[model samples]
Target: MSEASKHKAYAQRDGLNHVALVCDDLSSTEDRVPKYFEIYSHADYELGKRFYFHDDDGTEYEMVC
Candidate 1:
């Protein structure tokens, strides 16, 4: 099959939703990582303040607020 023919459109472009980077210190992680996009969504859970942020590269991350 040709490369163009094998390519999937936006609707069919299936891939990873996001990557979870575990950190011992949430504060440090936020401080070091520059936010590419505004918080997509956040919530308070048993783990702590969960903040979901998206990047320009179509990647998302979850960190503590």
Candidate 2:
């Protein structure tokens, strides 16, 4: 077996589904997001809406409901 495969247990195990963030000023954050990041997609959820974006380095981020 390869060396990298020996430490693959972490990824194979179950963990938290997702992380939730609480923003004090969501509207302000939403307005500023398009100036720096690329807003790629959006969708409506049961609670509210979600905005998906990526920065210059292409790291994915989301504004969740």
Candidate 3:
């Protein structure tokens, strides 16, 4: 990625509340992401875990909550 792309990723992170990523197969993303970054909660919908992943550039985001 270019420097501009890196900057845009950080800028976009600032505007987001939480990334509600839709996954056809959560397993794939889950497997690649770290377990420590996972945020546990029962409020969002059902009683399950959510992954809080940071981009390669260090922008924080949530997955499959």
Candidate 4:
């Protein structure tokens, strides 16, 4: 097995409101959304979208955008 498979990450929960990302103004994070979650990159954070993504190790990050 390669080094990439030596260790892995997983999600601990699955449901609505799994995570809460508090921000003063969600719009500021617009440009950076893609680096994390590709799905919300063009969805317009102003629409009040729920975005999620995982790091290289598969650790999930859910943000209420």
Instruction: Estimate the lDDT of model 2.
Output: 0.55
The C-alpha stretches of model 3 lying farther than 4 A from their native spots are: 1-13, 34-44, 47-49
Q: Per-residue lDDT for 1-65 in model 2, tens only?
A: 54223423123224532223545665777898888876666667786676665555434566774
lDDT of 3 by residue, 7-58 (tens): 3434554566445566655667677666545333212447444555555555
Model 1: CA > 4 A from native: 1-13, 35-41
- Clashing residue pairs in all predictions, respectively, total 0, 0, 0, 0
- Give candidate 4's error at residue 44 in angstroms: 12
* Best first by TM-score, ranked: 2, 1, 3, 4
Of candidate 3, the 10-residue stretch with the lowest lDDT total is: 36-45
For model 2, the stretches where C-alpha displacement exceeds 4 angstroms are: 1-20
TM-score of 1: 0.50
Instruction: Give the clashing residue pairs of candidate 4, or none.
Output: none
All candidates' TM-scores? 0.50, 0.52, 0.41, 0.40
Which scores greater on TM-score, model 1 or model 4?
1
- Shift of residue 56 alpha carbon in model 3, Å: 3.1
lDDT-wise, the better of 1 and 4 is 1
